[model samples]
Structure formats: C-alpha cells, structure tokens
Target: MKMWLPVVLVSLLLGGLPATHATAGTRSCNNNGIVVLHGMPLVTVDHKCVQILCLNGLPMPKLFENANSGCCEFKNTLYAPGQVFLDGCVKMTCEKSKWKPVGNTEFRCKRCEVFNDPHFMSFDRHRFDYHGECTYALTQEQFSRTPNFGIFTEFKKCYAVPSCLHRTIFKDNPKLLIGIGYLGLNAPKIYDILINGEKFTIPGDNYAHRLIVKEEDQDVLVWRQGSCIRILGSNGLTLQQCTNSIDIWAHPDLKNKVNGLCGSPDDNIDNDFTSRGKQVFDVEGFAPQEFAESWLTPPGCPAGRKKGSAKKNFGNDKMK
Candidate 1:
C-alpha cells in the first residue's frame, strides 16, 4: 500500500488554502483608548471631509510626519478635496471641489510662557465671525509667546473656548468588517476600495458590499473608497459617509439599501450609534456582545482629560 499522506499534505500547501493557524499576525489598537478595530485607524468618509477618526492617540501613523508639517497620513483623506491640510489650525471645509477656508486660515500666535500649555479651539460666535470662523485659539498668555502675536489685526485671538472628547467604541472581536454604503461623487457610481494596498471595485448600485478581514499578515487597511478620504470617525454617533443629504437623496430607490450598509444618510453629522444602531453593512452583524457595556455607550474618551493639548498644538502657532 502506498502511503499518500505526505503527497496530500504537499498538495494542500501548494494549493494555497486557509490553514488552521493563519500566519497573519494581529495588532491591538486603542482608538481614543477605545478598541474598535484591532490594528488600523477607524476611517469614515463624508463629502465634506475625509476624517482620520482618533487623532489624539499615540504612536500615530506617519499620517502627519511629526504633526508639525500640518500634513496627515493617507494623502487622499486629509489633504484631499483642496489639497490643504486640516490640522485644526485652518478653518476650512471641502466645498464642491476645493478646500475653501471657512473663516480664518492663518496661524495666530498666543502668548504662552511654555509652548506646552493647554489650548483649544475658540467657539465665540462673534470672535469666530470676526476671525472668519477659525476653530483654533489659545490663551492670552500663550498668544503673547506667538511670533508676531498681536502684530496685525488680521491675526486675532478667540474668546470662547472649545471642548474636544476622545469619542471611541470598545469591542472584543478583533475582526473588522466594513460595509461601504455608496461611492462616486454626484451619483452612486462604482468605485474601488483599497484594502492593504489591494484594490477591489464594487458597483455603485451595490451598497451591501463588505471588506471583511481579521488581523493577519495581510495589511487590511482601507486607504481610499471613491471620492472621500482622510476619514476619521464622527463627533456624533452615526458615521456619515457623504457630506450632506444629497448623496443619500441621489438614490431614492437605494434608501433602505444605503441605510442598511452605512446607517441613515440623515444621521450623518449627528446621531450616535454607540448603544444600538444600524450596522455599517447588512451583510455583517454588530461587534461581539462581550464589549464593555459602559464602553459601548457614547463619549468614548474619558472625562477630565485635556483633549487638544497634543504635541501638534504646543509649539509656536502650531494647531490642528
């Protein structure tokens, strides 16, 4: 009798089938100290901005190249639309096809004894309007240290202080399953999804497609999907895939379809899906139930911690 065991094993290995112990390694990621996906950053696409969700965490990807260059990781995401960096310093929005400055776009210096003091984006409506609705601000003391601080009226300071929270979600499952709701710019056109440097195209009409992957040797990070990029998560609960209602409105027939894959389009800028909400993709279910009950709720980051006092904003006029 011929022993065919060795031959069978060799065939299986050469055939490239999934083995029992997958060699793909895994990594642990703390998104705002909350674990959503194990390795990659949580990126959400919207017409207005391609947000890099947890911009506060450490060991940040070469996204910004030291956070001083005013650049973020993933070119199409952060510096897309207008090719301008939205590092919290410039008050600009992605309009039509370019990064237009909403109000103030220049860095205003604050007189600070040490460039490491805590500063935040000012929210004074009058001041915002005065300063062209800029989101960056600093203390008068900090402003003093600013070069050319108070040198020009165009270079103004903010009165109302703003607040930032490390919005996060914790899940036990290390696997990540993303459901792309829509693609294209004007209409729900077909676009390609870049996963771990590989591109996969899903038809525009099909919103139920999913990019499923667990931590492994396969680098399964979504770089680009259609018109949006540099996508961080949302401040509200629901992660908006498009800039406004138009994207959802464009597809009346696919309303339910889009909702199933990426939540309701109306729930874009607002609404939180922390407790319970529609799955990003209907094909896949929610994260495991083992996630911490408290952690699953809204407000992912801890309270009483300074949110915006990072290395990017502590130096001369550097704010993002």
Candidate 2:
C-alpha cells in the first residue's frame, strides 16, 4: 500500500494535475490596474498627450513635444506647428504652443474708389478719370499667386454720359464669380446682384462657397472675414457697391502684388500710371487718354469721343 501510494502521488504530479511552474521568457507591463504585454503599441489615457508603452517587463512613458497638447487652439480646433490660418485680415501661424503672426501683424487696408462720373482712385491714392465705354480690369494679381482674384468694371452710357460704371464683376480664380449691376446712374436702386450668373439675394450670410453677403444701409457689402479664408484661400475681397460708386478694399498682404486700374500698391503714387502691357508711363509725361486706352478689356474697344487729360495734381515726383 505504501509503494502504491508513492507511485500514485508521482503520477498525479506528472499527469493528473496541471504543472506548477513559473512562465518563462514572457514579459508584461502593468499600467495602473491594466496589464499590457510586451511589443504592444503606445497607450494614452484621459486625453493626456503623453503616451506609455511596455518595454521588456517594465512600462515606459514618453512625451511628444509637438503633440496635440502643444498645438495652437483656435475656435475649438487644434493646429499643428507651423500651420497657417487667418484671423480677420491678419495672417497667423502656430508655433511653440502659441499662435504668432506670420509676417506683418499690422492691419493695413488700401482703398480704391470709383465715384460720380466714374472717377478713379488707385490703391496708392492716385486719382484719375476714364470716360470709356467698355469693360476694364479694376485690379488683378498681375503675378499669379495662390487664390488668384480680380475685379472688372463695365462702363456704359448713363444719363447721356459717355461712360458710367454699369456693372462690376469680382472673379475668384476659375470658379466663383460675383456681379453687381446698376440700371443707370440716376436709378434710385440697384437693378440686381448676380452670383455665378444667377440672381442672388443680399444679406446672405451663407452663399457662394465662403462668401458672406450683407446689406449696410444703401450699400450692398460682400466680404470674407476671420477664419473664413481657410476654405477660400484668400485674405478676402471686400466689395461695397452704392448708388453712384464702388469701393474695393485690399488687404495689406496684397501690397505691391496687384496691378490694373488700381496700379501698383507699393505706397508709391508716381507709378500709378502702369499700363496693361507692363509699361509704366512717367507721371509728368502721363497721357491719361493713352493710359486709359491701354486698359480696354478686349484690347480694341471703341474710343470715347469726350477725351480729356487726367488731373495732374500728382507732381513730377519720380517713382522710388
């Protein structure tokens, strides 16, 4: 019975029961109350940007310098380092856990106005008059850049006058087009507003992609402000149309980057007579008639019979 007892005990230990031995060559890590095996991916908890991973039999934690925790916050969204965004007309970028201005932070806007009898005021503040009946480029990015845009004005006879701004077109690159038309100079109200060839209503907060339309008294305003340019890829175009005039505002970033009737916007009025063919006429010898004819939209529109010299109020100061 004793011999049988010994054999039975050995048999039970070898086969009848599971072996009681420590696991070999196996590693794991304990994170709080959770168990993680070796070779597992990094794990994050409670939205903490810091991550932990199991290496060998121990847990290792690492902090990422450029992680979401270090990103810039704008309007409840996170922006990675070096990501650029627009705050109103100001350009900003994310860096070192903060939002910083990308270039010049100053908010500078240049104004160009076309008023009564269609007097022209360039962005550099050089004023002139062109009495031609044809479509002409008001302002354009002569050197193509991203989000290329331009404005065109159509002149027609109004109240027997040879030239009056009958319609204005704001073209955004290859897709978006906005037009504001007037019946006549004396017409008390605007005839209509067009978006991509379709009649559109004013005061539209949401229309034509990212454009915001609103009515300010007698003027119809179209603009893109704040972070709206994230989708439009532009600082934004501000167009204000009234009964007898049109005002176009350009962002400071566009300084020295545009041409056409608005002329070069380098803060130099002497070069305001830049022609469509890239020829700059001397302000002293400036021939307003020839300069106006060079900007005819179709290259060969009918010449205005009532030709006159532009006000030579700008002196003989050479372009600097």
User: Among all windows of ten consecutive residues in candidate 2, which has the lowest summed lDDT?
Assistant: 215-224
Candidate 2: tens digits of C-alpha lDDT, residues 68-144: 44444333234566777554344566565444544532257677778766677888887666666677777777733
lDDT of 1 by residue, 131-227 (tens): 1111121211111222111001011122342232111111112332222322332223223433433445644331122233432211122222244
Residue 118 C-alpha lDDT in model 2: 65
| Model 2 regions more than 4 Å off | 1-107, 143-147, 182-191, 204-236, 285-287, 298-320
Model 2: how far residue 71 lies from native, Å: 19
Q: Model 1: runs farther than 4 Å from truth?
A: 1-162, 165-173, 176-215, 222-263, 266-320
lDDT of each: 0.24, 0.53
Question: Model 1: what TM-score?
Answer: 0.18
The candidate that achieves the highest TM-score relative to the unseen native structure: 2
Give the Cα error of residue 82 in candidate 2, in Å.
Answer: 25
